[model samples]
Target: MNLANIQDFGAVNDDFTNNSVSIQKTIDYCAALGGGKVVIPAGKPYLSGPFNLKSNIELHLEHGAVLKAYPDESVYTKSAFRQNMGEGTIWIGGENLNQISITGGGTLDGNGIFFMGDELHDSYELKPFETIDPRPHILTLVSCKNVKMHGITVSNAAYWALHFIGCYDVSIANISIYNNIKVRNSDGIDLDHCQNVRISNCHIESGDDCICLKNRREYEELGPCKNIVIANCTLISTSCAIKIGSENMDAISHVTFNNCIITGSCRGIGIQNRDEGTVSDIIFSNIMVECKQFSEVWWGMAEPIYITAYPRASHDHKDAGWRLKPGAKEAGIGKVSNITFANIRCKSENGIFLGAASPDLLDNIRFNDIDLEVSKTTEYQGGYYDCRPCKDDDFVGEQTAGFYMINAQNVYISNTTVNWGTQKPAYYGNALYAENITPLILDNFNGTAAFEHLESIVKKGKTQLEKIAN
Candidate 1:
């Protein structure tokens, strides 16, 4: 093994010494010798500025090693390779590489709290910065093939924790990410325009999405995000546990998430397509979820499963990140179809939501053997649905059903159970509510209204309802 140790290149074990140059020297030495393992040895904190990764090399940390980010503005700068990826540093960055990997059971500590602003007792807030907020993402590896990240710990990323863009043949497993729950956009893992990916056996707790998939406008040349699979993960988040998009400008399809446990989340599973994307052939099965509400500073309303497709206001957020060009030839309307959620057991403060801007935008969604229980456990606000980035009103204030489906077509539910808590509000009423659905099928559904005076089912507009008694 052509191994290069960071300490051999004059890297010191301390809290103050800058080890960025030494680490890069070690990586470069390994790459020059035809690719081998570069080891960050155990027993001390190696403080570092941002460093670049090389191809055909493995960066491994021995047990008990701590590689911490140096949080000084002067030490970090943008590279031509990292354009359009928000303000601040890419702490560990690589682009267009092959056979690169990061492993070993050590820690990469991103000192995220230094960039935070005054705490808003209600929810976390940040000081304004130019272009965007200035906090570093722990890792951003773009256009790399044959990537592997496993058996590592990434802690306290002020921005997205681990972001991979346009990568192929990736495997991420046996990893742990811990971010401050009050930090706003510190997503656990982000896969952008990548393909043939598999994530398994991970534990993540963050302030944002635990796992998110996207196809950003800035990287439209990478094409779609497809053939991805996730399994056996335990996630805790203040946002969605698994989210497809609010930033897709291309197709995201053929995704599967199964055998997961989600707890203490704001939204358990979500698909929020708000751009020119067609999201289809997605399946989520055999999962357990528990969620509750937080303050409105975050986007969720505690719905255990949320799926919505809508259009962003062209006039608004024109300068925002990941947005399709204002007048792209593709009709800016997003479409979602062929999604299935089966054998899900969820307990939440809100219901299952399927609201799209128009019926033509969503179709052919199915739910099977889902057990949903809506209970008021927190003192926070409830009885609303949030469909953001729209031209009209962003929220529905008086949602009154255990299952709220609006402007959808060909929906199917079988062997499902909906139960309301003993202490629910007045806005919580009907068991099922539908509007503008062409064909809705409920086979062996078991539920009733929250209150005796309210009807069990309420229908509006043209609809075809089929029911089989439980």
Candidate 2:
């Protein structure tokens, strides 16, 4: 295949000049010739602002080649799609493209620090409603199909590194992402309303969620995010390593995460259905998690696993410093069911929290062959469940258990072990806690505490425990 080198199209190798037009010309020429490779040659950094990609084209960055984003807000103006979605500009994007791939052993640098002001020094402490100078994302693909990204290093993204919206048949492998941990909202990869995606052998370290799957509210017409597989990935984040929702207006189903590692994250796995959606048929297996608390800049309580289904507005109104007034239109509670976590090990500061809004219970959750250890570390305070929407003042200074579930049904636990700290904190109480749960099953559940502790673990409404003989 003939390659269309950008140098041939008046693209200088210097890093100072704006090479956007040159690259676009090269891409257009290659795409006009019935689709070929647009190659950026090695040993020089090409600086550009924003450019749209074409269909049936591979943007190949050779080894030692660097594609750096121009560090000027004036260089990027909001596009029509971005303005409609209330999002920032996109540096490299394509719409309605087919058979597009970005493959190389090079780097794509966003120069994100130039956008974030000096206020983001150690912690991301900003004033009230202070703007972070919204910058363009590194790469975005919308309404595309058969997309592939492999063996590239994406770094310093001001926002998300890679975003796929309303796309299908995607494969991302052998990619590495390094984003500043102090930066806000530098998510590694975001799959919104995308389907049939496979992500494997990736190492991601980000300031926000490492790998996030969402059914975005803005793109409701695109349908749900389903049939995704993520495996053999190592993730580290200031927030959750893997997350779903907080923006789910459609269904999210048939997602699996297998054989992954999570380290130094605030939360291991989180499924937060705050909007009107149904999350079901999710499986997480053969995973290792090590989590600790972070600064107040982030939202999380160092939980190993957190799942919740609640109303969209007024749920965390007080903590969020706002409230929905009377007669305001509010979204109904979502549903979460058929979630499985098996063959997992976790070392964390906080326990598992599973919460559901009244009349919309979490159904058919199961834990199998799990080992969890909770200890009080200097990172943050421990031994308390961080279930939201409930009265926050009531849980203060109260003892917490290993597994806390409220408003759930048909929960099963088998071959699970829980170990607490040697010197139990004042808030360390039980091994398992349940409230308003029906048909709870426990089989071969072993804990450091005695069997009497299990019998006295309930702290709220009655849970009908079903004995399962092993």
TM-scores, all models, native as reference: 0.96, 0.91
Model 2 poorest 10 in a row by lDDT: 318-327
Give a tens-digit lDDT track for model 1, residues 1-470. Answer: 69989999999986788899999999999889889999998897898988889999999988888898886755656531246635455889999999999999999888888777877754467767665345788898889999999999989887889989999999999999999888888899999999999999999999899999988777789989999999999999988889989888899999999999999999999998888788999999999999999887777899899999877655545334337574543327678999999999999989999988788888999999999898888888778887765545678747647898888998999999999987798778788888888799999988898989988888888878988665
The lDDT for every candidate, in the order shown, is 0.86, 0.80
Tell me the deviation in Å of residue 224 in model 1: 0.5
Q: Which window of 10 residues has the lowest lDDT sum in candidate 1?
A: 313-322
Q: CA lDDT of 35 in candidate 2? A: 91
Q: What C-alpha RMSD separates each model from the true structure?
A: 1.9, 3.4
Candidate 2 per-residue lDDT over residues 1-470, each given as its tens digit: 65899999999867589899999999999889889999988887888889989999999989888999987777777442443423456899899999999999999998887777565533454222223234778998998999999999999987788999999999999999998877777899999999999999999999889999987655678999999999999999998899987677788999999999999998899997767778999999999999888765676777788888866544345422112222445655568899999999998877788877752458999999989888767545665544443323223224556787887888898999888865456666677787877878999887644234444356467688875754
Alpha-carbon runs more than 4 Å astray in model 1? 79-88, 318-322, 326-331
Name the lDDT value of residue 108 in candidate 1: 88
- Give candidate 2 misplaced runs (Cα > 4 Å): 79-81, 84-87, 119-122, 125-133, 314-328, 383-397, 449-456
